[model samples]
Target: MELYGLVTLVGVFLLLALEPVLARNPLHHPRLDRWCNNIGLAFTNELIRFFLPLALALVAVDGPWQAFNASSLGLLWGALLAFIIMDFSLYWVHRCSHELRWLWRLHRTHHSDLDMDVTTSFRHHPGEVGLKLVLMSGFIGLLGFTPAHLLTYVLLHRCFALWSHSNIRLPEGLERQLAKVLVTPRVHQIHHSAWQPETDSNYGQILTLWDRLFKTYLSPDQVPCPARFGLEDFRSAEDQRLSALFAQPIR
Candidate 1:
């Protein structure tokens, strides 16, 4: 798990470096301070998870879950089923984080970033990470997903999170077609809009199907173009500081 996590981290950074050179979005202006704060948050989150009991629990139960596999489903079919269940579970978890005020306090940290980029993907609060682990553990245990299935899903989830938050722009036609199935950059950008209505919609992380099925999906055309990013209430530079973000939930 540690090695896989390291590889995913490296891949994310590589994509971060390559995106601007390949297809940059003019709206995003990267800043050193913002990157530092974002990375700091990610480091803090990793530290928190490392010490959490949930991490140890996952390791201990991994082998047992595979050994007593009650599901006679074939490997390929089981993996696909697990992936869909995990994605669906995450959709509700994410949406609840917005609808519930307590969850919103922790989740708001991610939306406070004025500039969206690959680093923005790691800007979540440590509290939010812990909460997600708690929620995900329930789904993983209930669905009886194997360790291999969990690792693959985690890698794919991390990659897509980076891709969705990236500043690279795709051709309009292609982006439109992709949004029909997956959560494209344009679709995710709308979720970061400063406007409350736009921000509340498009809550899916990897698949667009959840939002569409739940009637929470909104296209870029539905809202103003070049939608303003970040929380309107916390737009100051000071609000993005590492210390400030760490204390934001209680504030």
Candidate 2:
């Protein structure tokens, strides 16, 4: 858990510094309120995370269904399976966040960002965070997942989340190959497209397998990279305020 938090923060800071040099579409040299607001939101979430019990802190369940047994495999294999299962869970959770209107309200705070950058990855609503926590915890418990499995998965997930949301462009050929298995930045940029149909697709977090299987994927070649992001109506200056973000879901 400590490692998870450390990796997330470090990845964000590293990306923050590196983004300008590597940015596909260079944003303002010194970002204004938006960047700070996103960071502020992330800090609040870190506090929320601190108070909430860690993912592995759950009491073991004795249900008939067991998703994976960590003891059955070596640690490396267990972590690999754990991430695959967790990514699958994320694919559904993320898809639901867009497909369901009420849930979309909680999710829009993230998409509401007019810009797509590393910080945008941390712009989730508190309610959305809590919702993910509950749903993901249930999945973990059902599987009887181990601490080691979860710890490894969280670090990996967060690192990829930051990478996927980054504005830095990867080589098209390399990204094309990666998108075959993993969700690349190009793939995720399509997911953030302001167009509703495009926004609703590419819900995979780590792996492209689920999106491809479920047919929710919009090919990067089709939509094009560096697509316009965020909801059209939600782009007003007032709408970007930190206070407005908290009230957004209910409003």
Candidate 3:
């Protein structure tokens, strides 16, 4: 699991470096400081996770209903089922983070970024990470998923999270087709729009199916205008600081 995590981290770092250089309309504003702050926040979340590494394992169920057990549904089918279940769980958790005031307070730290880049995917507040860990552990335990299933989902989840937040522009046709099945960058950028309604939509982390199923999906054409990313309340430079980001959930 640790090895896979390291590989995903490096892959995301490479994407973060390459995407903007390939972007057609990359932000002209200076991003170094914001990138540093976002990375700092990510590092803090990792530190928290390191100490709480067993949260998922501890909550895992070992009963007869273990769906992912090799003797039951078989490893392949079990993994696939577990992945879909977890993805669905993530959609609701993400949606609640916006609808519920307390969760939104922690979530706003990620939305506070003025620019959307690969690094922006890692801008989650530590509080949000803790909340997600608790929620995800419960979900995993309830569903009887194994360590391998969780690891597979984590890799795919991390990849999509970074890809959806990338600054790179995809070929129009390709992006359109991809958005039908996956959550593409164009689709996700709308979610980060400073406008409240847009910000509240596109809550899916991996599959776009959940949003479509829940009627929360918003296509680019559906938007009234092109989105200006970031939270209106956190537009000031001072609010983008690492210290301010950590304090945002309470303030």
Candidate 4:
């Protein structure tokens, strides 16, 4: 667990610290908004996720021992299985975050950003992270995942998610070819598209197959080119102001 924390902390720090300077595009959100979400909320959510599971899983699980049991599939296979499950779980969670009105209250802060960048990856609300933590706790416990296995899968998917959100777009042919296996920027950018159809499609965060399987997949060529990005209802200026933006009502 200590190493897990270290891995997450170091990875997040490097990405959040140097991505702006490394990427060619200018950082879109103000430094304050970026820090507030990436550093402030990240720390807060980390603490919440850490503690919440201890309590929530106590009565919730059949037994903690059961949760720690090894998968007969072996570590490598267990890791792969965990990765697929986590990605599928997150796909539904993200889709519901958009479709459900109340859930959108906690999730909308992320979309409020008009500018797409790496730091934008951490702009989610603490409430949303809390909900995810609860869901993750249930998922691991019910599925009998050891902490090591779960962390491996979580780290893999999260790294892909951060990479997908990056301002550094991939070479043209690369994204199309890779979308056959991994999630690519072009596929994910469509998820952030301002248009309704594109915005609702492409919910798969790590694997491209989930969207295709579930009928939400829209190829980059097929989705309309959004004239702009961000939530359909959000204005660029007001969305920059963190306090006012989070407090805005969903229309």
Candidate 5:
């Protein structure tokens, strides 16, 4: 578990370190730029506030499949099953985070950045990150998943998320075909759009099925918001961080 955590954290760092090459344009906001100054401060505070509580919750809980004694083959299959189940769970979690008000508060932190890139993936408020960990961890325990299995599932999803954030566009025809299986970059991009219709749609992360099932799916062509990204009211990037962590709009 610790090893997997290290790998995931390192993956985030690698994305941050390679931001220049991976981003579509030069990154619009620096990690410590003037506009994002409050963002970093809030991030540090939220991490301390949330992770400490989350750690205690996880320690008290029993992980899934904690009691099973199985053969090596069984373990492999168990892990595979675990990954699939977790992916489904994450799909719903991501969707709900957008639909619900409180969850949206934390989720907004990640979306505040005008530039949607891999670094944006890690720019989440620590509180939001901690909440997700708790939710995923509980789901893991409830599903009887092993630590190894959880780690594998986490890595796979992280990779998918990074892919979704990439600046590269998918061929329109190809993206439509692939959305039937996994989420394409085009499909996920709609979720990042600052437009009202676009912002509330395309809630899936690794899979597009949930949005389809829930009727939240919107095609890039039909709801084509091919305009500048980011919130309309918050014009300047300076307040992106402030609004993200502490001042959610009363809409």
Candidate 6:
């Protein structure tokens, strides 16, 4: 857990600092107030996810509710299975958040940001945070995952997520190669597209496998460069205020 915290801290620090310098285009959100509110909200949501674990099965999995135990498959194989499950589960949850109306309301808080950058990665609503945490924690019990397995997954998934959401411009060839397996920033930028169809595509989390397998993959080349981000309804600058964003789901 300590390592997980350290990795997360480092990931956030490096990307938040680098994105502005390496940004492909000029910085969009110049308002300092919006930055403070967005970052503050993100911090609160991250705390909930890091601190709450009653729902996560970090101990023995002898309970009768166990559906399938991967421990029988050996440590390496079980760990592999756990990693795949974690990635794909995140894919479905993200996909469903778009398809399902209520989920979209919560998820839209993330997309509602008119300006997309590394900090946008941290702009998820508390509702979405709690929802994903509750859902993702189920894998530990069902798959017989230990604390170490989950902590490792947490570090990888979260760091990759921050990276994918970042605005740093990667070289075209390198970005293309990485996007073949992992969800690179270019690929994820399409998912953040303001266009409805594009927004519904590229639903992968850590890996692009799920999106390709499920036929939701959309190539970055298919969309305009720096695809327009944010939702149509929340386009105004004032809508991005901390209070408006916090109350958005109900509105």
Q: What is the TM-score of each predicted model, taking all chains together?
A: 0.88, 0.90, 0.91, 0.81, 0.72, 0.92
Mark the regions of model 2 whose C-alpha exceeds 4 Å error after superposition: 28-30, 50-56, 61-74
Sort all candidates by lDDT, best to worst. Answer: 3, 2, 6, 1, 4, 5
TM-score winner, 2 or 6? 6
- As for TM-score, the candidate ahead, 2 or 5, is 2
Name the regions of candidate 6 deviating beyond 4 angstroms: none
Q: What does candidate 4 score on TM?
A: 0.81
- Each candidate: RMSD: 3.0, 2.4, 2.4, 3.5, 4.8, 1.9
What tens digits encode model 2's per-residue C-alpha lDDT throughout 1-251? 57777888799889888888888765533367888878878887777665553532355444456665554676788788888888888888888888899999999999988778998898988888887787677677677676676777777778889999998888889988899998888888888878888888999988899988999988887776545778887888888889999888998
What TM-score, to 2 decimals, does candidate 3 have?
A: 0.91
RMSD to native, candidate 2: 2.4
Ranking by TM-score: 6, 3, 2, 1, 4, 5
Which digits, one per residue and each the tens of the lDDT, describe model 6 over residues 60-134? 365676787666777677777778888888888898999999999999999987766777778888988987776
Q: Model 4, range 70-147, lDDT digits (tens) per residue?
A: 466778877778788888998899999889989878887777667676666777778788888888777677776655
Clashes of 4: 0
Candidate 3 Cα RMSD (Å): 2.4
Poorest stretch of ten by lDDT in candidate 6: 53-62
lDDT of 3 by residue, 24-111 (tens): 3457447899789988998888776655535655546575544444325667777888789889989999999999999889999999
Report lDDT (Cα) of residue 20, candidate 2.
80
Which candidate number maximizes lDDT? 3
Each candidate's number of clashing pairs is 0, 0, 0, 0, 4, 0
Candidate 5 lDDT (Cα, whole model)?
Answer: 0.63
Once fitted onto the true fold, the runs of candidate 3 whose alpha carbons sit more than 4 angstroms away are: 50-54, 63-71
Query: Number of the top candidate by TM-score?
Result: 6
Residue 204 C-alpha lDDT in model 5 = 74
